[model samples]
Target: MNGGTDLLGVVSSLLGPGGGSAVDPVEAAARVAWSALVEPGDAVGGLLVQGLGAERSFALVRAAVDDGPELLVESCRDAGLPGAESPSVLTGAVAEALARWGPRLGRVDVLAALDAARAVGARLLVPGAAGWPRAVDDLGPHAPIVLWTRTGRRADGPAVAVVGSRANTVAGAEATAEITSVAADRGCTVVSGGAYGIDATAHRVAVAAGTPTLAVLAGGIDQLYPAGNFELLRNVARQGALLAESPPGTRPTRWRFLARNRLIAALGAATVVVEAGARSGALNTAHHAAQLGRSVFAVPGAFSSSASVGCHRLVAEGRAQIVVHPEDPVDTVLGRSRHATPGRGRSSSSGTPVLAGREDPEVLRVLDALGRRALGEQELAARSGMSFAEVADALALAELQGLVVHGVGGWTRA
Candidate 1:
């Protein structure tokens, strides 16, 4: 038998034991076969064909074959070249499994796939890659095994995760936009799952601001989860990166959504829950951020609104900092203000001044309103009277300035 098939058989045998502790040998073999068969910078199609199962393998092979033998021929051409073939096969195998199972597999399967993928890639970044974010890993082991990425021409930078409910209030949408703009001005990349409400707002604002933003897909990178966000996803990929743990052609699943949250948390220096109910998925993301040791922030809402409950609870439990304004630049809330501080008169080319002991005036106003008590935006606005737009603009400025901090419920002085 060809070494590829032999490897698959081996991994299959290991997996056949069907016990909690048993490692699937077939999977291990698949990992080996994948590493042998594919190369870095090679077309993804050829890799899929060489590593996938019988039924799926042939289909993918056919697609690549039909596209003309360029990719397949290249794979064979580069097979023995140095740096072309990776030392570990585990990553390819795990990535294949993630693609195959889609969202059906349990936490064990996901972890195994991630482990294998990282082993093979030799760049196993979890929530702690130098850029490993504590926010996403807080999801615990349910976190993604690897973040398959291909950076762009621009420098890789910090990102903020903006997430909220699908059926969100107008206020929520506005908040997302304001917060995203602030992040962009601070030279931070905005990360989101590309969902509705807050996620959409965050992306749109980032794009409009001419800043880089990334979208973490719960499904395949080839397909956008929400059909409506297809254009937005494309824009993000062009400006920044679109990431996925699973290979192409996978569909979104409930468990994947929960798992996907970790990516947003992990990628972002800090996580902001824009608007979520007690049971909202955004709250789940906040929990993961806490677990990962990332700073958590929240935007407070109306006391009577169900959407505000999650943020309120997070603040009460000390799980999140309350953000009253988007511009408050304290690291305690967004976890990024520390990096934004000026270093000996050096200013980032972006023109946004680094924090240097000075504070944003808008953040000061919001803090004065919070005064050791969590206050919703409406109350803060009523007390400050600065129009909603003015308040939002100030908050966004303050957040970037590191003068104030935001959390689950509202904003406070740092």
Candidate 2:
């Protein structure tokens, strides 16, 4: 047999009975050598044995048995070793595989790792792909190896991540919805971790607004962690996508949750912390965003509310922008007005210079009635008591005159 095939057989043998501590060192070395040959699509039986050595590797394999073969291979590959191709490998095979491959494992760089992952049915997403989130690339090296996604449509728009504490207040939930609604209406996707509280509210509102939203999960894409969010996650998958770095069937763990925060931050143009305690996990997302150079905004709550403490600290430390409302976030991202001078109203008479100045009372009233929410032409006519033709003329003039802004569904005050 070739080195690779021979190593595979030896690993299988070491995994069998009597291959425990009684196994010969040379046989054990061969078993370890076999593990180094693991590539994507290899069987898991031998790999499992190689991973669970006579002692340490054994327990590790047993503990991870439920994680599935893909995850096992990933773990092995990450450890710079090969995984067994079958279950019958001796317990000592893992050490042997490691020893054999240890010297030449330098070839298994990140690119090779990605190739291996793809060979095993997992898709590798890099920055600049149609579905590649700009937010994630901002994470630098801390970013995930690859995002394993299983959705029909990949998200392809600017996304605002809404994160907060699980035990959020009623006001926090309301704010999350309102902010998410604003984002959706403005053509921004919403990204969250599919957790309870603010994350769930953001996704719900974004969906209601007919906007795409993405959910990053700490567990496998196929496995929903918080069982409570299974249905919600399904809806997100239909409307947007559910992304995970781990292969399917991997369970969520505490470390995974922490690492997942960086993904959330990197996937968004900006992150808004609606509510979080002093030490809430949401803060981790904010930190990741700041580190990635993405905008981090925080909604301030009452001084007495524990949930708002983290946000307050973030803003005070200059790590985040203080967003009193959703518009503040939008404006921050779009940038401040270049002209310092105030805008002027258009003259009713012909031959007037268009300059930055205050608007007339009539125009102000019309805009005030329109509010921040978009109003259709007919709605604006009815609200402003202007004739249909006059409203159309006014709206057209307002847009050209820079008194108001036009958007997809309707018009909103500039």
Candidate 3:
């Protein structure tokens, strides 16, 4: 097995102390190599690297692989890493890992990656490095092996994530841009997974507002995904920052996209899901944010829209608070003040206007029919001039947002 000697030499030459960096060359090279060695968000790889130093762990894995799959499984069991304590259970896992990682081991070139990053003025960032975002530490064992960063500047305050569906609506995109701009202007950095729709809108607005926005990518920084956003990502790299855990030459895969969500969630002080379906990847980021003890916010969408289902679910279940306006995150991070810009209106849907820049035309009509009295679904549908089916869907969403409630009598405005 290749011990990555040539890879180390290349990294050493590229990461010399010319920039006044005191980081060890060997360690940097090992991190770059390790990033290529395992997939992003590999908890076992993180555990191994943290338990043993990256270089030592790299050597151990290499030696074990060279010793063959059986020996590798034995070594893993002896090391007592999670999922490996049971020798029988670990054997298959080790063999599978060997199959996945072995063929690519000889192909990684840390030098090429470093050179590619340098060509674009990006730097390879490891833990403990200056400008590293400490918030990512919240990921614990699932933390990234290395980060490729464009901007050398780190946020002076907490970063907030703005995420949502790629097929977002105009209102959702507008909300993301507006919210991100407000937060950035209020001294927060905007972090996102750098997909289209909401992610693109957030980054553009933040940059235009002169707020530092971080684009957390699934693929290599050198290989920006969604080819359509190439220029936009380049602008982000130049003006704000572009970050990726994957090394150069790595393509964005479905698994990588899912794994990258954790980084976006962990890097933020809070996560705001602008719009998401029940199965949206933005929800995944929200889940990670909640797990890390970060506040999760969801922007309410029109009740009839599928895009808003996840956000409504989050709000109704108390998993997240409703963000009616852009300044909610700013208030959470910088502390609420009388002088702070007003949010959509109230924190909860109770006693708050239903169509406050949220409800669609149909939803507005249905809400207007509710008035101040209780009405059955059929009666409300007739009064609102909407179909019964439409009324039912709208009421479900309104109830979830706490805008309306059902009781012994029927439905009433909350």
Per model, state how many residue pairs clash. 46, 39, 0
Displacement of residue 153 (Cα, Å) in model 2 is 3.0
Arranged by lDDT, best first = 3, 2, 1
**In order, what is each prediction's RMSD in angstroms?**
19.7, 24.6, 13.6
- What TM-score against the true fold does each predicted structure earn? 0.51, 0.53, 0.74
Highest lDDT among the candidates is held by which one? 3
Question: lDDT tens digits, residues 240-275, model 3?
Answer: 788888987678976577778889988887789998
**In model 2, where do residues sit more than 4 Å from their true spots?**
1-130, 334-414
Across 318-351, the per-residue lDDT of candidate 1 in tens digits comes to: 6677886786422433344455432121112222
- Which pairs of residues collide in model 3? none
Model 2 agreement with the true structure over 114-208: per-residue lDDT tens digits = 23434433443433333545555444424443355645455665677889988899989988888888888777778999998888889888777
Candidate order by TM-score, highest to lowest? 3, 2, 1
Cα misplacement distance, residue 195 of candidate 3 (Å): 1.8
* lDDT of residue 51 for candidate 3: 62
Worst 10-residue lDDT window for candidate 1 reads: 342-351
